[model samples]
Target: MRRLIASTFASLDGILQAPGGPQEDPTGGFALGGWMFPYADDSMDLSAAGFDGKDRELLLGRRTYQIFEAHWPYQAHDDPIAQSLNAAKKHVASRTLSTLHWNNSTLLQGDVVAAVTALKSTPGPDLQMIGSGNLIQTLQAAALIDEYNVWTFPVVLGRGKRLFDEGATPSALRLVQSRVSTSGVVMSTYVPGGDVQPGSFVTTEPSERELDRRKKMANGTW
Candidate 1:
């Protein structure tokens, strides 16, 4: 079976919204856009190249789809990353958009979770999700993601939409790979490690005598 990989670019404080421009996503009064621009370097390029090399189909949310539709198609034919993105089969998870402008794009209809699950079971290349925060949250909550490629930048935005929000379905993951870029970006790959194992604290409960002794010590009655 093909894996479903979810990738995200996040700030140190975990904000994943609009790393491109101020107009990209100003929701919740987020003013800091293009926050990840300064750290662009060879390592970033290499990371993009690595993603392009995955030989996977593309899965995206509406916002991410719109962003790519506006830019990647205009890139030169010789650009490897752009070519890969433009040529790959794209499935967009959107409830409102009735039509897609990008080539090889398909609108995911019906229940989002059901649609994605059906895709996961189909015979084809792995599905890769890039820069789709809202979609990522849904896939995560459904426990459908098989792997996560997190490229965590060094700076913190302090506020914005995060990659992983609260109330997500509890699950565990194992770090399978890690690397550090020259600009302090940490790239980590994680795979699903199944359900979280519940464990109790190792320390024993304080005895009554021990508690009384501590109380006496505090009261100077030791």
Candidate 2:
């Protein structure tokens, strides 16, 4: 069985929308499009390059799929990223789209979680998902994602779509690798660990003696 990987670029505050360009997604009054452009560095290049060598197919949401279909096909053949994205078999998750214009594209029908779970069971290279916040949320909720590649930029966009939202089930992750870019981007790879173990450290009201000790310590009278 092949693994399912989700790769996303996000701000410090967890906004994942429109990291590519201004027009990429203007929904919900998101003004900070193309926020990740300035932080591109050699580390980012190297991280992207590693994925270039991997045998993989793409899983995208409707919006992201349309964006790639419009841009990648027209890009020069020598552009490595374009070539890889255009040539790879794309599986798009959408309820409205009936026909896909891009070559070798498949529309996932019915329950999104079930369809993706079935896809993960198939033999192939890793199934990669990029820049699909909605789709990623569904997958994360289902616990279907096997790996995550997150490039966390330094800047914080106070509001936007986040990679992990409130609806997502609490889960633990184990960091596989991490690196910091010259531009202050923190790139990290993680794999699902298990269920989240919730714990906290707090004490109830102190006893009389304990309170007296605390007061003495505060007043330097211990």
TM per candidate: 0.87, 0.88
| Candidate 2 per-residue C-alpha lDDT over 1-222 given as tens digits, one digit per residue, 9 for 90 to 100 | 788888888999999999988999989999989998999866576435234423689899999899889988999989888778877888999999999999889999899998998888888877989888999999998888889988899998999899988998899999998989899999899999998888756557778998899999999999
The number of the candidate with the highest lDDT is 1
Clashes of 1: 0
Q: lDDT tens digits, residues 1-222, model 1?
A: 678898888898889999878888888999998898898788665434246624789999999999889988999999988988898999999989999999999999899999999999999998999889999999899989999988899998889999988967888999998889899999888989999999977489889998999999999999
Worst 10 residues of 1 by lDDT: 45-54
Q: Where does model 1 exceed 4 Å of error?
A: 45-50, 198-202, 207-222
Each prediction's Cα lDDT score?
0.87, 0.87
Which ten-residue region of model 2 has the weakest summed lDDT? Answer: 45-54
After superposing candidate 2 on the true structure, give the runs of residues whose Cα lies further than 4 Å from its correct spot. Answer: 46-54, 203-222
Q: State the lDDT at 148 in candidate 1.
A: 91
Q: Pick by TM-score: which candidate is best?
A: 2
In angstroms, what RMSD does candidate 1 have relative to the true structure?
5.0
